[model samples]
Target: MGAADARLPVLEGGPLLRKAFPDHWSFLLGELALYSLLVLILTGVWLTLFFTPEMREVVYTGPYAPLRGVRMSAAFDSTLRISFDVRGGLLMRQAHHWAALVFVAAIGVHLLRIFFTGAFRRPRELNWVIGLTLFVVTLAEGFAGYSLPDDLLSGTGLRIAQGIMTSIPVVGTYVAFLVFGGAFPGHDIITRLYPVHILLLPGALIALLTVHLILVFHLKHTQWRGPGHTVRNAVGKPFFPQFTASSGGLSVAVAGVLVLLSALAQVNPVWNYGPYRPDLVSTGSQPDWYVGFLEGALRLVPAWETHVAGHTLMWNVLLPAVVLPALLFAVLYAYPFVEQRITGEWRDEQHFCDRPRERPVRTGLGVAGTVWYGVLLLAGGNDVIAQTFRISVNALTWVLRVALIVAPVLAFVVTRWLCRALTEAERHRLAEGVSTGEIRQNVTGGYESDHEPVTSFRPGAPRRQLTAARTGTPSRTPHEPEHPDR
Candidate 1:
């Protein structure tokens, strides 16, 4: 309506920005990812100003005395200079590392939220795909950035990466060459990965994140059924002031926490590890948590090798490093479609979020997956666990092997039963309001709870639609829609 608004037509859609957002705490998990990424980008830019992405070896002769004249990569030396010489360099580097760990962690938890709540059904399936893609790109970005320091631990990680790539049967070697920019520990690796870590992967991550947010805005936020909310409408605070304050405050808090942690916590101490050597490696070295699961899998798979016609197949490496992770992610990406097919329903997919208790099978699957990953994660530190507990390493490995198979199946069965019980409990509570501390006498003189039927007890307006997502319950209210979760 004004000249300024006319000049910037994008501002004309300001009223559209008034869209409501659910105040649910679980909804903030995605925001954690977004804010942590902002921190990572800002700190990463600061780090890149001094980082040298060359693999050339140079003798270290810096203020730190331990490795005063030892040979190390230029990448590592620049990393040392950035750590000791540049003001706030250590803080920024640590913050960047911590932020990356948090970023991937947020994505993982956010994905679990979406899956358990059935938010990836129907119209939001494409959004799920986009979110998953962003997740994957962020992992790549983290790995590239992690390896740029060229420490001993990172060198081991790269070696594992190279081996995984070179295990792809026919074209593995060529792919590895392309990725590493030649043979193992290629001289040009840091140079090649510099652009990818700083620009390419981050660029893709930003673009994909933009698309994910755009799609979310288009569909509006999904929410649980609350008081006065219907299948056609979502209930929550609007974005203009209240939710905006919450978002701003959350962003600041996330940044402050990262800063504090970076100040106090030491992560990825590359200087102590010395420079990466192809022939040298340290004992008891481990990667960051996100990569830990894969490492665990690599350790767990039995050492079974196959030889056929002079070609070798290392099942131990291929199964855990390559095939398992691929199949797992493939299943995750395809789950929405698979569920849709099983249910044979789609017309009412866009409205209210499904309560986890309302979806027993999905809840069970989520639990099973969590347990499976948890076992593998613990197995990743098998050597440490054995040493700490003073047990044989092989014995610990065998125990983990049994646990991996047994735990997930046990979790699946228990979760499904728990979900069903919770659903039944909710029904009983709805039929009879929560028990007050009062007792009443029945006709036979037996005492019982004096309870009143409470329709709903959650905050905000009561949900009008009693219809579940899978089945259409008869509507009592005049304006209620015929379909469930419409």
Candidate 2:
């Protein structure tokens, strides 16, 4: 046999090679995340060559004149060198940061598509859980990267993080000591986080991504229900030529876009923030965008704390920093099962997806959660927003605080109503075609409007009946005999 024939799957005739992948644009969201992650990995490897993840004190004498004689962490010093001294190092750094942002955002939108479509139901629950775990780890990985630069803003964040850790009632302080390698701004936090940011977390993320792709390949993808689409069959492009080109081209395009963004837009200039000094504070410092939600939550939380039996409980820190995220992630991890429980549709296989209009409850839930998180994220930037809009920071905080309470409730109610309304309207349109903007005069000389049924939906005939009629086939019902002449 020739080389091509020899590589064939024995007697299977390359059956697995032609696996179908749904061609919908929504599917690109997952590919966007994968491509962004690839960018992160590539730029991260480059960064590792110059990054010094040590917290040793050093006097800066680098090219950046702002902190010429100031003492800073070695990690921060290296960051400055990477920005100013190393050629293209700043570009790569920004590329990696931007890639991380897109990665999380793509994952978030992908989850929305999967959830609203009921694609996570039956045989896909495990994949959903795996995706959730990946999200948690991705968030942690971003946080680790954010902290590695050892700038003032990141150090302040670390201090706040230590406070949250110590608020765990009993074991919090011990956990903080163990993780921090000692007390606040411990001697070796950057060294500790280096392995996690560059090695451990990335390793876990890649391994999980492998398993996720394997499962997706094995289980096949879910497509919308339509002609020739069902539990056993999907309608889409093949894997070899069309899908490969489209997905690969899109990934490369996204990487190029990130490169352009990095070149044009400066991000996270650590030199400007200076080194992490426990006593010094910058007025307008802010964390990365992904970390903004937590910052907002922390700001919105009421100032409350308690002490029981000498164990202090910082409720303010605990609620927003610890309890809130924990609860939200718990809900996220359990959402597929929760939806299944509520709907009571325990089918083993689902090859078709539900339109958003068909799943009002799930759609409403998604909208509510998105609104709540978005409000929190905006709250994180309230300081900047207030200054820009010339409003009081305190006033903006209160507005977002009230929004945090009322927005989700309002979003849920409004979304449910809208979905139900749209669904009913769609049903009507399906039964009776849209207005043709034509009117006719009756015998009595009064104008009467006329309605037309869609071509496929002939009043009494729905899709099922229409298909049977066109195919000249009868369904499970007995049909009256047609005359031989007819």
Regions of model 2 farther than 4 Å from truth: 1-14, 433-486
Candidate 2 local Cα displacement, residue 86, angstroms: 1.2
For model 1 the local lDDT of residue 41 reads: 93
Compared with the true structure, what per-residue lDDT tens digits does model 2 show for residues 1-486? 245445676415545546788888999899999999999999999999999989889999999888999998899999999999999989999999999999998988898889888789888999999998888899999999999999998898888888888888899989999989988878988999999999999999999999999999878998764445556665787776778888889988999999999999988888778998999877777887777899999988888988789877889899999999999989888888877766665534555677776667778888999999999999888888999989999989999999998999999889988888876776677666534568999999999776655443322124444455445444212221111100
Candidate 1 shows a clash count of 6
Best by lDDT: 1
TM-score of 1: 0.91
Candidate 2, after superposition: displacement of residue 136 in Å?
0.5
User: lDDT scores for all predictions?
Assistant: 0.83, 0.82
Clashing pairs in 1: 226-463, 227-461, 227-462, 227-463, 228-461, 228-462
Q: TM-score: which candidate is best?
A: 1
Which residue pairs collide in model 2, if any?
none
